[model samples]
Target: MGNTMLYVITSLSVGGAQKALLNLASSDFSRDYPPVVIALVEVDGVQKQFAEAGIPVHVLGINRLTQLPWVLPRLFGLVRKIKPQVIHGWMHHGNLFATLTWWLAGCRPVLLWGMHHTPEKATLERKQHALVLKVGRWLSRFPQQIVYVSRRSMQRHAELGYAMQHAQVIANGIPLGNNREQAAHYASVRQELGIPANARLIGSLTRYVPEKDIPNLLNAIRLYQEGGEDAHFLLAGEGMNAHNPALQPLLSALPDAIKVHLLGVRTDAQRLIAALDIATLSSQREAFPLFLAEAMAAGVPCVATDVGDIAEFVADTGTIVPVADAAALANALSGLLNQAPKVRESLGEQARQRVAARYSLNAVIQAYQQMLGKVATYSVSNA
Candidate 1:
C-alpha cells in the first residue's frame, strides 16, 4: 500500500522544507529505501513534483478542525496497511501527527522528527498551537532522533525541554549539481516583466509575511532610490501579491522610480534567482535560509538581514545587515549596486564556492543515513 519510509509534513507547498524533502526523496539514498510522502493538506503545483520523482504521494486534505476526524481514520488505515519501517516527521504538526499514526497503527517504526523553523515568541500566540508545542515537547522523547535543520533550532528546542540526548543538527542540504542558467535565461524574465536590462535586478523569493519583513525591504528600496540609484525588484512566493494587506500599504507608498514585480508562487524559482543581479531578504527570523544558499550556489551576490544562521552562512561572500534597519539595507544594496560588473562576478563566484564547500546534498544524505539505522528496537509489527 505504501513505501517503507513514511515522511509526514504539515502541508505540500513550494516551500524550503518541502523542497528539501523532495531532494531527499530524489536522492540515491532513497532509491534503496523509498519513502511514502504524507501531507496534511495539498497545495497546487508541487504535488506534481513528487509524482514526477516517482514517489507515492498521499494527502489527508484536512483543512479545518472538523475535517480531522474524517481524515485521520484514512491516515490510520493507511498506516496499518503499509506498516512503514521509519516515520520521519517534518515540522511540529507533522511530528505530532506521525506519532499519532505510529501509535494507532500498533507498529513501532523508527520515529524521526524534523525541526525546521525558528522558535519565535510569536508562534506561541495561539492557544491551540501553544498546546501543540507543549504536547510535542512532552512527546518529543519517543522519537528515535530529532533532527534540527539549524543548530539554533536544535538549541532552542533543547531549551524548551526537548529530549536533547538523541537530538542532532542536520542543515538542509542544497543540491549543488544544478547548472547555473546563463544571462539569456534571466533576460527572458526581465523582458516579460518590462524591466530594463541595465536596471539592477534585486529579488527575494519570499511570502508577504511579518517574519519575511517585505515592508522593510520596500522601505529599503525607497531609501536606495532616494539616494539616486534606480533598481527593479522581483518578489515571488505565496501571498506575495497586490492583494496582501501586509504588503499593500508599503507597496502603495513606494515611488514610481522603483519597480516592484510581484510574481506570486513561481515554480521556476531557480530561473528567477539566476536572472538577478542581487538576491536579498529582510527577514526578522530564520534558521538557515536555503534560498540564500541556492542564490549563492547560482553565483548571485546576496544582501540579507543578520538573522539565525545567515551571518555564519554568508561569511565574507555576501552582505549581512541588521534587521529592520532600512538605511543599512539601502546602503548594502547600494554598495553592491555600485560595484563594477567584474567585481560583482568575482564576489558571486566566491559566494558559490562557500555553498559548495559546506552545504552539499550528499553530506546531508550521509548524515541522515548514519542516524537511520534499522527501525530502532521498536518494529512490533511489519504486518
Candidate 2:
C-alpha cells in the first residue's frame, strides 16, 4: 500500500484550521500516512512545527486571486510528482484548489474536503465564502468525502445546497496532558502579566475580528467591573496588541478598575490559558472552537456564548450565555467568579474529564484512520 497523504491548506497561520491540520499531520497517524503539507500562501507561524515533525512543506507563494493561474501549473506539477494516494484539503480555498488541481493533474487519488467554519450571514467574507461554497457544491462529487467539524455546520451547508455524496462531522480534538504541569506556571504567568495574585483572571484567546465580538466582551468586562468585581481581563491573539487602533475605543470604554492585558499573538497561548481562572469565547459565530476544547483540556472552566457547539462543549462544566449579550455575559462571569474556590476547581476537573473522554487527539486520529482506510479501499476497488 502507498503510505502517502498530501494536505493542502490556505496558510500556516496561527488559526483554528491551521492548528487542526498541524495536529493531524503531527499525530501518530502520520506514521502510517507519511504526510506532506502544501500551503497556498507563504508559510508563516506553523511551518517550523511541521518541519520539526519531519514533514516537508511546500509553499506556492500565492497572496492574491491573480496568482492562481501562475500557481496552478506549479500545483499540478507537484501533484503529479508526489502521486499521493490521498489528498486532503483544509478549508474552502484549499478544498477548491485541491479538487481543480487533482482534476488537472489527471489523478484518481481519494480527495477529502475539510470545512472548519460555520456559515454566518452578515460578514462580507462569509458572502464571498458562500460564492465559493456554491462552486464547491458543483464540484462536490469530485471528492470522496466532505468533513465538517460541527454537525450544525454540515446541516447548514447541506441546507444551502451543498449536497455531497459523503459527509461526516468530526469535532476538533485537543491533545490532553497533565493539568498540574500548567497549573504550576499560573503564578509566574500572572506575575509577568502584572495581574495581582488575588485577582480573578478571565481570559479570552481569539483574533480581533468582527465575528469574535471583542467589543461585546469588553462591554461585558465593563459591566463586571462596574459591579466592583476584582477581576482582570486578558485578551490575546492576532490584532490584540496595544498598537491596534481598532482596540483603542474599546479599551477606553473599559472601566479603570479592570486591568486589560492585551498580549497580541502570543506563542505561549497554552501557558496563558493554563494561568486563566476561566476561559472565554465571545464569538457570534463558530463551528467548533478549538480554544474552548483546549481550555477544557487544561482543566480551566470556560464561559462562552451559545454559539456553534459551545454549549455542547461546556455542558454542565461551564457557563454559556446568549450571543452578543453583554449583560448576560457579565452575570455569568460574575456568578462563576463568586463561586467558592473548591466549586470552581470541581467544575474545572469536570471540564477536563469531558475533553479527555470525548475529544482526545487519540480518538480523533483513530476515526480519521478508519475513514482514510475505507476511502483507500474504495479507491483501489474502483481502480
What shift in Å separates residue 266 of candidate 2 from its native position after superposition? 1.6
Scanning candidate 1 in windows of ten residues, the lowest lDDT window is: 374-383
Model 2 lDDT tens row, 276-383: 999998899999988889889898998999988889878999999999999999989999989999999999999989988988888899889888878878777988
For candidate 2, the TM-score is 0.96
RMSD of each: 2.6, 1.7
The TM-score measured for candidate 1 stands at 0.94
lDDT of 1 by residue, 1-383 (tens): 33488999998888888888888888887865678988987567589888888989989987787899888779988888779878889988999998887787685777889998877777677687788889999999888888998887887787778889888888888876355355666788888899877777999998766788887888999999999988888999988888877677888899876788999998888888888999999999888887888899888989999988888888888899999999999999999879999999999999888877788788888888777753333343443
